[model samples]
Target: MSTQTTQTTQPMRTTQTWRLDQRIRVTGGEVAARVLGEGPPVVLVHGTPAWSYLWRDVAPLLARRHTVYVWDLLGFGDSRTDPGAAPSIARQARTLAELVAHWDLDAPALVGHDIGGGTVIRAHLVEHVPASHIALVDAAVLGPWNTPFTEHQQQHADVYRTMPPDIFGDLVAARFRTATHRALTPESAAAYLAPWAGSEGQRRWLDQVAAVSFEDTREAVARLGEISVPTLVLWGEQDQWIPLSTGERLAAAIPGARTATVPDAGHFVAEDNPADTAAALLRFLA
Candidate 1:
């Protein structure tokens, strides 16, 4: 693999400032995405409570050499979902399959983070989406992936769904804070918080949380050995949500898969340490 590294001196742009205006109709709804750069194609997927903005810093770096495609999953970010639509892992995977087809990409490199990782894996294995390379960054591919917050939300969905917008925003912000090792700047925090600011956003957020299930991930785990593409399992060394050991095991399970860890980052590695995260991806994709 290539060991090249990229350095940037430009001021870091906040996720709030990142805009994805392109919309594509998928299975259930329209997904917001943006394509950048040239060369070979790459698709980046983000996890729960996060939109493509999660890749605001990392995508630009990768776009320097690769055509980067970033999208917000159905029901998240600027994406539109049908009323009462649940953005489950399985459903998202199907959408991903359709997206790959829509993009008409031929064996493009795929990168996913958190639940996005689950979506990518399921799309490749279950949906039979082909990729030249696959990278999972702090992915939730193992069983018992749900947190106490998710468990409680799943059990009492109605309660959270009706939570006042201010309270719900506070709750979401608190949860998001825990995903990173370092403090997020006010601008960065606002960018993440923007999607879940209103009643509709709150309902969509709860719907996604309620849709979280271990079954989808368990199915992917059972088929890990069946993966044919080059795989890279990347994790945040300080991930409090899913420990690094899980990533190590995931890498070990996939035949010939490699592993890399980003130090000083938690579950949200991209936001906490985008430089190293992007570098790791560049090195692998090279």
Candidate 2:
């Protein structure tokens, strides 16, 4: 397969959002990432089952005033990873730290959603990367996050990987749909589905699903108060995956951390309410 894609570059804020058209070498695999605009640095990390594409709507807005970098975590998106490699959260955090150091970023501001939130938190508290500021949108910061389905997938990943292609696609589509309050448009659904449509893709997708663990968050939660950098805890008020209550508890744990609630949004706040999400981030960043 070709390493690059045929996508025409467009200006920020156009209907054609920026794409992750480049690959950066990382520890276990190459990560798909993109950089747009220029100024103070800001890195956007996406959570599991989603890629840097999740930031398409938000990155451009931030890029208007700051250099923005968005990347797919290992084992997701165009970032190819060895199926034999463990897809644990620590591995994801290590990859995030590697990318930040690879870019020679100096205390860049970080914005992360879902498991991406845990990755950045681990990068900051455990990996010792200095982030000027952090914004966690419905982050999985607290422990005991695995659902029954996820636990079963992890325990029987081999069996799950053998699912029929059509069945696998339907299952993922259904789960992705639940993350948003608004129904996913065909185009949006296709964008999220593109990375995990085929047999091999389905196997890797299961690997990621099975990789979700509480250990990473358990470690980060213990040190939440040590984060002295300015922080913002943004959440979708109607989040079903990680509740708004979790966001509130996280905000309370971090000293001087401010909270912003995005009304009418679900776990996928960027997809559901990018305007309010962007506005909250911009306010906190300022």
Candidate 3:
């Protein structure tokens, strides 16, 4: 089985590793998470094809001011998987609520990217989530939004059902760019793909990708009007996956919400524009 573990960085700097050292066992799986520091909780949820690791930089920065929680959704990161099954984002959202209750977080603020944004919204529908504010990073809220490459994305997700380990890694490395679509160092790129090693690992990505139904997601996106908390909309100006128009449409649908465009960042705004992402968040939360 192919397991992509971290490459040791030179142990000689003031910078510290955000060691992988936490877990939360929710229904359907035991999620791996990274938690550190302390204050009123801020939950950070990652997008598809990525795990808790994606929040490495953003989580720590937020942690300095609040108890930040970032975790892998079921079937992603080190979380368990069930082949041929793609758990709906609704289920993922429920699991998220359960996790929050387990942690005893009251009135926690939420920040989510991609589908994570949708999950946060849906969680609110379930009632009394202790949510103070909700933030979206290039959220896919304007639905019926199957971009030009949507079918192509589906085909690649389908291939995971049978691709060899090395081939799967190579394929993911090439296609992952489609998500972030930025210049990633070889090591940095590999670290993101490492969690999905081997057949079982490869299946996880496939299941989640296939689950991204445009019809269902559109219906959910339309429900944004139900959100009753303070909302912040942050989008990457260079994002190629979800259009800027979609972001604008989302800001309009959600009452009292506003949008900020990250000048240099793309879909992976947190990593590409960490400081700006943090600064905006700090202000929003404050």
RMSD of each: 6.2, 3.9, 5.4
Query: TM-score, each model?
Result: 0.93, 0.92, 0.86
Clashing residue pairs, backbone N/CA/C < 3 A, model 3? none
Better of 2 and 3 by TM-score: 2
Instruction: Show the lowest summed lDDT stretch of 10 residues, model 3.
Output: 7-16
Could you tell me which 10 consecutive residues in candidate 2 have the lowest summed lDDT?
A: 6-15
Order of quality (lDDT): 1, 2, 3
Better of 1 and 2 by TM-score: 1
What does candidate 2's lDDT look like per residue over 208-271, in tens digits? 8877788877888899989999999999988888888888899999999999999999989998
What is candidate 3's local distance difference test score? Answer: 0.72
Pick the lDDT winner.
Answer: 1
Q: Give per-residue CA lDDT, model 1, range 170-213, as digits (tens).
A: 89999989989999888888888887888977877887887879
Which of candidates 1 and 3 reaches a greater TM-score? 1
The residue ranges of model 3 lying beyond 4 angstroms of the native Cα positions read 1-18, 82-85, 145-150, 153-160, 215-220
**Comparison by lDDT, 2 against 3, better one:** 2
Q: What's model 1's TM-score?
A: 0.93
Model 3 earns a TM-score of 0.86
